[model samples]
Target: MGEFAKRHQSPWPIIVCFALNFSKVVALLSPIDFLFYLFAGFTLAAGVGVITARNPVYSVFFLIAAFLNAAALFLLAGAEFLAFILIIVYLGAVAVLFLFVVMMLDINLATVRAGFVRYLPIAAVVGGIFAAQLIIMLLIWQQSETPPTLNALGNSPMNQPNNVYALGRVLYTDYFVAFQTAGIILLIAMIGAIVLTLRPRAGIKTQVISQQVSRKSSQSVRLVDLKLGQTHPTTAATAPTEPQEGSA
Candidate 1:
């Protein structure tokens, strides 16, 4: 309690949270947990910096830091599988791929800035809609102070008749056909839309009506007349090759 009191005065209690959790490592309060909390805050700050950086390369670095911090938080929450997955899938793999792609893609700031004036109106409308949605969500959320928690009921309808797993079970199993049908409908609509907008572009290879109409078999082929002339033979290896032994 004294350690916490000292921490509260500094306006930074992450170290306190880390120390409190770390002290429980030996089946008791782990003192080192305060460090993890502090680290998590730094990671979040780095992630924000990365997103705001003008250079895509710097942003990728910040993204990596954020994923690492998120994984740390997951571990603190007792989710080892999720924590490792977050690090491996996001930090180890996806971040590197994004870094490589960003490095390769050439982005001209001048070209991008040129379109700002023309797109300002559309951008403003979209931004306004997003702001409105955010305000509505915040207002609805602020109406309640208590944090949401799931009731661990065994006989939940989302699961089996008397079981409780997750709401996803019925969604994936019972509604899988609907999902597939929706996918096929989207595919057909996409194909139809593509066909609707297709235009025969100029200078493309195609059969010409004029060429076909003017074509004639006689013009395409001719039998050339040649005068018969006697010519001396060069040489003969075997006039008629020794007759294959009596095979007349």
Candidate 2:
């Protein structure tokens, strides 16, 4: 009891020691390196969650989390524009759209999961191919002799006044042709998707301009004289009749 009371009464020493050790570790790593590792770890964990989550909606949320952590990593790397793009475009728009769509869809989990085993061999082959490609790329990158390059604007990032200005300048000037080409490709893809998905369906109403132009008021409209209390005869005849309460 005395030992327990002593340990509980003077916990400040342990707290101070832990703080000192943490400060030393932070000093060795620097705040930037520490934050990079922190965000990177979070991004990695979120990516794993994205692939492992059973629910599509949960997977989308995990993907969003990964995007957010990646944005933080980008911010730490001084690419503020890319960071915000990840946040606003990918997270705010794309990921949220995916989440809502997944939630709204009537998905059959049993049907989806049933395909996993059947496709496992194909998936494994694809995964192995990708893994091999990645390993080869990593080895090639490690053996490359050329030093890292700067932004496309031929200026160091530190010298630029703002990231957006530098990025826009590079994109519009140095890579203008490639940028336009990408835009054209995206436009073509969008057109193809629209064409494929806009196929006509049965029982759908469509406008006919020539028919509308050739139509006359006399063909579509009817003028009838009726008493104030009487309904139109055509409507009266076409109306559905309800069953009498006791007759059925």
Candidate 3:
């Protein structure tokens, strides 16, 4: 019975076949295409790890890895601006924020894992729909005709030695208002976040700008007339009380 079960259920042969097929498929891709697939695969795997990791810190690390892999993929696609933005913005700031939040929150891992497992089916369905949409989009993009190498402003990308310079010229020249508007929106969001999270504690003292600015010398200072030898009333030593009888 053991032999029969092992022969029927052992997956080694199937795994070997799949591996061979995958190797054959990989061998057909050019070097650049291989690197693209490599980075893309890492990005996908890291994204999965971010969500599936039990430890929140681990999830953040995985998220950082995903960002790095995605940045590499962007670089391979000649999107240097986007790649640097991913690295500088997401990896530098957002990932650090996620890590700090995870560390400081002191989350209950058991409860989090339980909740994740409970909602896993729903999450899986949503993830499947998103994956399907992404696949369809990718297929359509692959089939679509490539546009001319010229940019929106009638400038050839090849003429610009630096992608950043080209992107900046177009952004500042044509889309300056929109860019400033985005900055304004981001500023508002930052202010809103600060307002939402800021709480006043009963015993904590905070600097009041209005009160400080409005204060006059008279409000903060007291004029006192005194003899040359006399100190301020609050600073002068009190006369020692006569020792209470038998108190010592």
TM-score of 1: 0.39
Residues 102-127 of candidate 2 have per-residue lDDT tens digits of 89997767788888988999999999
TM-score of each: 0.39, 0.63, 0.62
Candidate 2 lands at a TM-score of 0.63
Q: Return the top candidate by TM-score.
A: 2
For residues 64-181, write the lDDT of model 3, one tens digit per residue: 9999999998777677788999899999999899899999999988887778778999999998999999989967974764344334535345234577876777567667899899
- Candidate order (lDDT): 3, 2, 1
Model 3 TM-score relative to the real fold:
0.62
> Which pairs of residues collide in candidate 2?
none
RMSD after CA superposition, every candidate: 14.1, 12.8, 12.3
Writing each residue's lDDT as its tens digit, candidate 1 over 1-248 gives 12432344443344455456744533432344454546667787987787477777887888888888888776554455667878998877889899998889986656866898899999999989999999899678637443122233332232233222333344356566887799899899989989999987988898799977996645443333444773323113333323223221
- What is residue 223's positional error in candidate 3, in angstroms? 14
Worst 10 residues of 2 by lDDT: 239-248
